[model samples]
Target: MTTAARAPLQLPWRTGLAYGALAAPLAFVSLPLYVNLPHHYASVAGAPLAALGGVLLATRALDALIDPALGRLADRLFRQGKGQGHAWWAAVLGCVLLALGFAALWHPPKDSATAMLVWLAGALLLTTLAYSAVCILHQAWGTRWGGAPAWRARVTAWREGATLIGVLLASALPLWLGFDATSALLVLGLMLGLWSLHRLKLPVAQLADPVAPSPDRPQRSPWANASFRWLMLVFMLNGVASAIPATLLPFFVADRLQAPQWQPLFLLGYFGAAALGLPLWVRAVGRRGLAPSWRAGMGLSVLAFAATPWLGAGDGAVFAVICVASGLALGADLALPAALLTGVIHQGGAGGQSEGRYLGWWTCATKLNLALAAGLVLPLLSWAGYRSGSTDAAALQALAWLYAGLPCVLKLGAALALWCAERHHPTWRHTT
Candidate 1:
């Protein structure tokens, strides 16, 4: 094992907060890109749903495909001489590009359909690429701060908790402050996050290694690890389940529920609940261990989502309850899997050496899930005769089923996969 992997982590709450600060802004940017952008273009910008789906699929798929290479770049930046300095500069560049791309994405030229589509495609590519670079670096950094499973869960909790805050802000701000102000806030949040990271005391000896790869000790690829593959299967299935709801949330709220005004409230309730429930999940991790806690969360999500198809207009209150329930489950989704993956990396003897690569593929699955949700779901909805503001019973039913029912099935599958892994693979038990 590497010295860095063996080093004990002494993460105080203050340092954990500092280390996780950047996640807030990065996630702040993510909510709109993933959740709101599709609705915006389809409804507000008058873009054709099928074409927009095509664009999102192409750009996001391209974005996901390149993550492994970017992960390799991150490894080089961390392994080379003056590694910390190089990584810092890379993050700075990513932030700057992120800010610019975000602005462009939200304020696209609506001169013509062709122009808008072109602008949206370009902007999405730039924003997602920049987001991936910064996010992979941040995740890799956290993974490098090696610790016991419980400690890793705490680190992930801090980061994911801040992420929920960012999600809450993103959910509320466009409604309260408008998109222009929201964009400005994102830039400011990015700046503040970067500043906090600047003040953070990194594990310099761990991250700033100047060693060149020895010919005899070739690095292992993340794909070569069986545990990573199994874990990613569950992660990707679970992510697709989550992504479907996110993709369809606005439409469900606006059309099916006939409660557009309540969108912000629903969003706040969801993410607020997630943020508040993080501590509970962290404790669960400590007590029950990562996989069990994650399975429990999946079960909770399935139970919450099962009631959605029965809901209709004026059932916003009941839906809010569902949101809170599902959001609590979201806390587990956010914290535990990543923690488990950190354990997987260390156990596989990758540790500080290949954290970026593992997390890169991790992030890649995440994007592909979103991409698949948007690319397939939107076009499929359109094909099924469901428009954004439709009140047709069949159409609304389709939307509800896709939004609610599919996720439950997928979540259950993920839970089952996790359970089988636990039963079959003893290494999975030790990863915690």
Candidate 2:
């Protein structure tokens, strides 16, 4: 590395604010797609439950498979000197797809089942593809120009926090303002996204060293990097746990708690707490290091999930507290993993050079977690004799077990894996 190219790293505040503003939308879009889409399709389109699930399952699975390739494209684009503009393009495309997707979702085919399936598949695939591309590019953009651990942490915090704010706002917009308002909120979000894109000061790729891959290694599959695999394994496990409740909370709240009206309260508490908790987790990251703090958060989640089954009907207050605690734990989930992965990228000799490829795979797993939650778990629960509106004690019990116990089991696995990863220094020490 030449001295000129290795000049001291600095944080760009205008760039950070722009980046943070862009995150406001990314955060809102996913929850709606994963959590609300099913109900929306069922009610608005008159689509059958089985067929709707099948379309979402097939299309999203295909979308997840393509994310790595998209990430690779993003990497080349980033290195090709477009900088953060790649994300801007991806965002524009995402916005277009998402708008079309939502509009289709709002007004389905007259044939009901057939048209709904076709529209859902095409629109979701397009929307998911664009969503994945923009998200990967955005993370890569921040990492490329982020400079240091502290700056990267702040960048991630601002983005994730803003994302939570979007989630909270979107939660109310659809309920309070109606679908028209919902569409308007999304359009507003896209505008902020573009404006933020304009605000970013994308760094020039100064290092002559290659940041992308050979033609043979398109997509830059980080799977070949053994350390990344270890980190991914841990990440996937924990992610599934987090995803389970996110996907099922509506069902559980309505059926088990018998209080569907409180759904907003639950989501608000969870996301709002996560936003507040980010700074505290940042403090923990400073004191205990990213790895240790992450493990601690997982432990907190484990305990929280373990305690979930004890709550009964009219337990909204208790559950709200649970959401707050779990979201507090979520702060670590959001902040540390990326920060730790940034360290991994740095150790893998990537960092500013190859964050897109590295983050692409990370983002891939992240999406799959949601896909599995919605596509796999819902059907599996149905197969197991659990229905959303069931008054049967046995069926309701199944919902609780899935909503809490399963996530607890996954999180426990993650905590155990984290312990082993640290002892083995699987990714960290190996890369070192």
Candidate 3:
């Protein structure tokens, strides 16, 4: 059951599509949770912004911390029953909780502020926990598929491409169909994804050596691996580079560009470009290998963001070009890193045994990057005299620098680190 034996030279389109289908719903749920939920509570539910933020912060922090545990749970489930039966059941249960919790979150009780706040906390906790569990499980399932570098890139590309489509739908649908209808769509999507998963036959887990850790034996921790740590370092740096712009996008659109009317178009173009570029990046992986392709993406991102400081009120068109270019680079970010992580797991001797653990930490790092972006950037922006609608020249300049310039610097750092990792680190040096 070695990786090469399991991974064929070519993966069927049907198999890739079926394995990736679940990601759409999972991603569909994520957009509303982060972007729309707070707005709904504040404007629609009349919840205090401060109190709402507190509840969200607490619940999300708890959710991120528990991902590793959930990853371990996924590992245990994979070990249960025949093949992935127990894991599949767990995912089904997670989907049920996710749908219910998501529905409840949007339809909060119209009671006292305290009661509504309490309900929000409870619902959010349930939804986020379920989301994390299902997400980690799905990732573990894919990692256990155990493919060559190109096949692994294709696997991640399909999943991430579906995710971009889901994000696009979630972004637009709520505006057109409203929350109730959108929630219904989410439920339906979840059901479809779950059914696909039930029908799909994933590759079985395998170990490089015969005497690796058994099902009952204590598994090695992902943190204990030097390669995992190095990969995470690169991941976190790049993640923060990406997260800063995401956290500041609306403000940048409203104030920097002074064209809030075009915000949707910007988002659409960005994600659309990413989705469209997935194939090209997969092809790039086939040509240049994973680490090199990822560094190239980081380089592309930096070049795209370099023009941001010069963009002003009437520069929306120019900014849109930047979005499209950076979004193309995003294809590599989404597809290659996780593929590299899969290779890391196998190379580190934890392939099938600890895929869940590794992905759990990976998910944790992603969440923490988002959290860190918001936690540090907003306060720093305010301290520098930038506000939501401020037109002050200095303030706007600060916003531009924080939103665009900072990420470029960070991306360069990440790109450098990636190069160093590939050149120096034994675990990362091999072709993925």
Candidate 4:
């Protein structure tokens, strides 16, 4: 058990809630960058699917590579902030960069396809760098506030729950208010979130002081811990499974379901259910422990999504049910992994100092998963003759198989990895 888990700690309710506001704008920007960017460039700017995919692949690859370095920078800021709050300044700078890059992305000054792609590459790189720094800092902040498993669960839930609200808002706003209004909302939310963060008192880094030293407490890399590696293996497998659906959902709904109008509803249902399920999952964690809770959620998701391939055009309702069930599973996805990671960080003796590094690598894994989903799946779909807005039966069939079948297979792999870790890995078993 972790040191934090041996004693009870309670975050003030208001402070817990206030920090979560930051997740909203972060997520607001994410839905557009990952989900909408490809479709926007492909259809609106007339960039070919292959070319757009290449751009995303290249840019996100670079972005993912930068995460560990950025994470180290976040650690420096945390250490420096022992006397003066340099971390806040860094976070503010990140939010500024995020807003500017986001504006430039949606409203590119370029007109031609090549010019637009160039703009996208530059803007996405800038935005993602800023996003990574801020996210690593924010997550590390929460990690420092850790207590028991239930406390960690509550922290993750508040943040991820707010993230779901942000995603839900992002998905619906583009349709209801259009891109201009949606972009404006993102800016507004970013400003407000930063403001709230500025006012909220953050958890102090107990080991952030440079002058302090415990010669016995050497700082090893987060990767030196075997438990972290096993957790990450499970996390990446599960992440790929989740990201595949996210990448394909718009196409599936528009073409496969023939219910383009239901697009917002599907997104809303998924995110909203995930938000609603967060508390329940947290409660489950309190009873079952993190590993069991997470495995149970994974099992539930495989069963729920297995039925996805059977649904057809008029099955929007069925899909909505699938969305809810799978999204309930999403609550576990969002809450448990990070909560378990907190224990891993505590065990690695990096709780206050190197949490940023761990989260930074976690961020890299996240970006890699999205990049792989887009890089591999998009090009493969194009190669298979599945064009956006195409009504070809063969194309649609290929899409269905890739979208629904592939994720279930990946989920099963992730579940098996989790099982093996539980049975064979002593560190993983003891930590939980």
Candidate 5:
């Protein structure tokens, strides 16, 4: 009981943010993995841009494919407790694999297209699997510790706030210092992540509900729990809304904004704002309640995204403000979903063993969001006469629509889905 309970208090507020510090390195790595890897292959590895893009498409699909099994593995490891099953060890393995993958991809030797493909594919697979496992466990660990609305919000806020700081650090370090600094930060970040993982509070299952039988390892019985299925549906719809803008932001900035200089500025503001605003949102979550707080986030996201299509050249000021506003909205986005998911976990009677299974599904939704975002945006942008670097007014307008309008529409869809979830179900709520 003591050991399970000790998992949550691994660090103080500032130090727990160290756990969030892991986000910086992960995001920094994601820079190359999703956002910049293709570019590197094209320019440095001499892979033709077309071939490189295809390779990325194939490899990323593979990476996303293997995530659910890994998620389930995490569930089992966590189920048996950290020492017995080596849950922290498993997470550390993934973290180290992530860093090594970056190192391998960054400093490749055999500069052939085939070599690059093999190397990139191998690395991406390991990293994605590891990331999915670590994140799912991290989320489950948080959710396992049931609490009041404010405390739950605080738990998520600590994680998201660290992620924001990491984003800022990753953004600034590489730009100002260089890749070597990036490498150093990643090493330090992983150490912190491991340390924090050791300290993170796991739910004292015995204390939580002695009368309520503990959940054991999850099986392939997801829909067997109907409420979990419905919540997942809502999550999937909303996740796609968030993913659309993420996939197209770089394209929008480079081509439409025609102001590459402001790219980092915009991202920094948005992510930085998310880190800063987390505490405030936690307060709102406490006062307004989880359902209402989540509703507020969805509403803000829809409103802020809607304003995106109206900006233009020299609209940096407006865009900057939008970035800040949307990021504040992001604060809620980060905290509430996981909190709600935890509620779902408790309610679905999955409390005994399905943490990993539920989180695995959650990870699947996350990857699907990214895939759908890219699958929808990239092809749509191309079809709309928006090429990679075209500045034609019509093309730029299409870019704006892809970046802003489409996401807004999707966000509204997500909002509607959540409304349905709120009205229809509370099976996940268990007052044990």
Candidate 6:
């Protein structure tokens, strides 16, 4: 069915906030996994860098590979919900699994290096699986509630804004409150977010919903669409650009800046700017289209990163400014692409049925970016005579290049790809 046939989503700010509540906890949990996990495992547990890299690569790749299947499972559960209990039950189960897995991961159950590695692997896999289920279901639910560009942007903004708050909390809490307390907070946030989610009036799914094409019909893969392929290409490159810095930030702060104490300030500057910039980005989407606005963000990011190479030790103040600038760019990064994807789903007439599938693949790409950053980049840095906590000038310079130079190159590539895609596929403008 065409999008015009469906009941339009009219989300007031209150409803949007309620629907987006879960995003905070999800993002809160993510910071430790991406930003803190490798450092913790390496320093605290004493896992060999190469071995740790290999394990992370293998498990995250495995997780990435399964996202599509998990997406399918999420779709089935969503369909089964049909105003029944399937979706709610699945989400609850996912939350329980996530809490258990996260607790085990942060508070390692074993002391021996080998046992710790094994436990880390198992726990990461479980955490990742639960994360995928909840993420795909939530994304699909939002997609099913379709709306106009500004409205859709508002929905995405609320979620992503909450996500920034979560990231801010995660970044700060571990430094001050410690991992144990952080874990407790995550559990609390998850419970509260889930409760808030139930307050949003979700649309009921019909048995033979037109928005969901018949399962029996020959279905074209999401990749079959030119717009999707182009968008995914841009998303992957942009994601890698963002993920590289994320993977390296702690190390950069500890080594290059020589001020580990400033870590929370940097994170706060970045995420706080992102949260504050969401409203401006939503307005930019209303003025320009998604692709153009996203391209603008890319440009801003490159400009911000361009200054990083010159930053030396005790440049925390300068770095904080960079963080705010890049974080403003991050608002566009977080909000626009997801809104564009929802538009793609509706255009394909697969809003209710295949959103999970599309978003599943999207999740795969997202994980792949993180995997490449942690799995490939870290090991490469190790090979290049750069070790974490090293004060060697040469090693610090190398760290700077990896942390700064690489992302600039990737962001430029993403910007170019976005331009090419928009040049050829102009139809996406109206959708955005």
Model 6, range 1-432, lDDT digits (tens) per residue?
433443343456787788788999998779999999998887776777877888888898899999999888887887773462677678888989998899889767555778888898999999998988888887777877756666677778888888888999998998899888887888899899888876678754321222555566555788887778988999999998888898888888888888889999999999999889888888888788778888999999999889797788889899999999999999999999998887777666666667788999999999999998888888887887877678788878888998889999999999999999988767456533
The per-residue C-alpha lDDT of model 5 at residue 270 equals 89
Report the C-alpha lDDT of model 5 over 1-432, residue by residue, as the tens digit: 222221232235654454454555566665445554543454456654444445555666666667667767876786674342477778778787777766666665565768767776687666676677677767766666654445556667777766677677766566577666787778788787777667655545422322232445335466576667767777777777777777667667677776767877888898888877787777776466666666688789887778788788778878888898898888878887777676666545566466677777777777767766665566666667766667788978988987888777877787787777767764223212
Candidate 1, residue 261: CA error in Å? 0.6
lDDT of 2 by residue, 1-432 (tens): 322242122335665578777678765678777777776776555666656667777787788888878777877776664445655666677677766666555555666578668877887777777778778877776666533444446667767777888888877667667666677677788787777777667655332222322334333346666667778989999998998888788778888898888888888888888889898887776566667788899998887668777666898888888988888899889877886676566545565556777876787788788778777777776776776567888778877888899899899899888888887663332211
For all predicted structures, in order, the TM-scores are 0.94, 0.89, 0.90, 0.93, 0.85, 0.94
Better model by lDDT, 1 or 5? Answer: 1
TM-score result, candidate 1: 0.94
- Which residue pairs of candidate 3 clash? none
lDDT-superior candidate, 5 or 6: 6
Residues 186-263 of candidate 3 have per-residue lDDT tens digits of 889989988888888875433232233345656678888777787898999999999888867777888889997787
Candidate 3: regions farther than 4 A off: 1-6, 37-57, 107-120, 204-218, 426-432
Question: Which regions in candidate 4 have their CA more than 4 angstroms from the true location?
Answer: 1-10, 109-111, 203-216, 424-432
Residue pairs in candidate 6 whose N, alpha carbon or C atoms collide under 3 angstroms: none
Q: Whole-model lDDT for model 3 versus the true structure?
A: 0.81
lDDT of candidate model 1 versus the reference? 0.85
| Candidate 6 deviant stretches above 4 angstroms | 1-10, 109-111, 203-217
Better of 1 and 2 by TM-score: 1
In candidate 2, residue 239 scores what lDDT?
Answer: 92
Task: Flag clash pairs in model 2.
Answer: none
